[model samples]
Target: MKFGNDRNSSRFRLPPSTAYRQAMRYDDKTLVVVGGSSGLGLATARAFTAGGGRVVIGGRSVERLEQAREVLGDAARTAVIDTGDTASVTRFFEAIEPIDYLFTPAASYTIAPFDHPDEAALASPFDGKFWGQVRCVRAAAPKLARDGAVVLMSGAASARPPKGAALYAAANGAVEAFGRGLAVDLAPVRVNVIAPGTIDGDLWRRRPAQVRAAAFAGQAAGSLVGRPGSEDEIAQAVLFLLTNGFTTGATLFADGGYSLR
Candidate 1:
């Protein structure tokens, strides 16, 4: 929560240059957060707005978009897009101009035992998280600025998925793989993925208070940091992928070293 010098962090420090400076500051830059209605996506959209960037937030919910706009003030813009649907994806991009940075933190995963998975449960995660991002990238590719960069959201589950996430794991894995391949096809337009570990993201907030507390505690015990990741922690990594000019086709882990365990 410190919001310290995230740009100069030891892991992704960049050399001083005009482009580097502009990339770091976001002034006059057009940054889009596809799932910016709430949670980590909104967190990142706020970060960019704070850095003097022009922000347009897209999501499936209108109420959340209004809330985000209220939180972001006049610096933010809003759009509704359900990345799971191809038509929604195409229409969303058509209404927007070229973008300098595109961040897709929109994701939904269904946790279920593979033994008795329902059809909707099996497809919902991929529909939103995996194909959602894929649809966004493909739709926006032609509209991305020459120096544009993209950051896709993957999860630690792709690497060390647990027992109850057979389909979710495959979806995350596909996202990472798609990012790597797209980096080649896109040529200079940078494409990178971030695989976050167990974080207390908004998805968990709807649970009862006691259930939330116990779940967080259990997650904390498994991390190298002895706690779950904060939303700001993941936002820092997202900014790194957005600004670091040299980073492409890379999958950075901000999972508190949980995968190693």
Candidate 2:
């Protein structure tokens, strides 16, 4: 089902009053989603667009960006950008004027034991995923409109700290810290972080089936709900944060109790 633009139609229609309220809630708002070509980012873009916001999706791959644009249809805009590069980040932000919402799911990580971690393997993530968010937030702050909100992505690794995932854990930890600090600094702009657990999606599609299954099993074992999360679930959390004006400096976990166990 589609929302916002008339190019697509929704399967379910709301009562006239409810539909009017929903439209008034998000009509004409502009959302910028970095790394929005796939996975959680793409899901978030769809949620915002469905709520009547004009969404702009940014990513490093032109092909993926075009694919995303196709999926989002006319209500969405696309931009090619590498968030790691300061110049590219600058240009992307400059091109958009007075954005009402910004969401970044841009990150990279290396899984390795701390003792023998490859310095080279860490460089890209350290620069792109960790500092990439920093640079994007820095560039986006001035352009964000009053009452605007920014949601950054972190992960369960930041809190879980499993073996052979030292680098990923650290990077996520840094991201959480960045969100906390930025929330204070970007007052009235409503900055927050979403720390999602083992969500069942295509992010690990390249891995072997057995590997994926075992990972899912492990997540089920740890989660109180005994299951992995879905991309749609995480996307809903993003929507909650974006719409809830009172929420800021918060780390909303969509982990299905993975962090508890």
Candidate 3:
């Protein structure tokens, strides 16, 4: 909710007060959002569009892509990109022109306990998120603007995990570590990761209404801020990572102190 951050405008952009007043407009920027059909990715796309940026959302579902396109209107476009598939990823990036930013919030994982976990099961989360990110980066790197950046999605669970979530935690850990290494590898392209705490997003909508409400309440109470995070809050963190030229190889947490709790 706080818009006083430096990403709105930098300190060198005339008076300090003017920076706060300036809207965070992307104008000429082209942002490609993978997994953007819904949830955090879609929210991020909306933020960039509001800032006057052109956005192309990527996902596998034609129906979902159309839904996103309908909601995002003319300022946004959608592509059927299955980031977990090598051929799909290669084709997706191949068809696109150069872009200024890449935001990947795509993820899925099994919830089974770690007791006697199968090798195939162990690999599922990694294949889905960890390697998917790797392939997306590899495919998108050449097309990315030299001065532009990429924002990878990680979770607070990567650092602090509850029971039945170890695999997910590990996968997210790989993403953060990979992002730092990628930032080093890519140099001036500026790669960073966002380790968000639990937010009330589309993923939560799958549960029954009362269950979802109770779960949100529980998570909110556990956080120091006494509330669940909004998707827009996480989107702001994504925007910060993309706009702040000085930041790179950093994992920014917007978890409302959930990690502390």
- Which candidate leads the pack in lDDT? 3
Q: Which residue runs does candidate 1 get wrong by more than 4 Å?
A: 1-23, 259-261
lDDT of 1 by residue, 1-261 (tens): 786568767766866665554455778899889999888888888778877888889998899899989999998989999887889989989999888999998766666666654787888678868888988999999999888999999988898777778888888899899999998998699999999887787866877989788767866777778888888778878988988889999999888876345
Model 2: per-residue lDDT, tens digit, 90-186? 9999998798988999765556566765677755456757888888989999998889999988888788866777777888888888888898998
Top-down lDDT ranking: 3, 1, 2
Candidate 3 has its poorest 10 consecutive residues by lDDT at 12-21
Consecutive 10-residue window with the lowest summed lDDT within model 2: 5-14
lDDT of 3 at 251: 96
Which residue pairs in candidate 1 have backbone atoms (N, alpha carbon, C) closer than 3 angstroms, thus clashing? none
**Candidate 3 lDDT by residue in tens digits, 82-142:** 8778999999898888989999887665654566458777677788888888999999999
RMSD of 2: 7.9
How much lDDT does each candidate structure score?
Answer: 0.85, 0.83, 0.87
> Distance (Å) between predicted and true CA of 124, model 3?
2.1
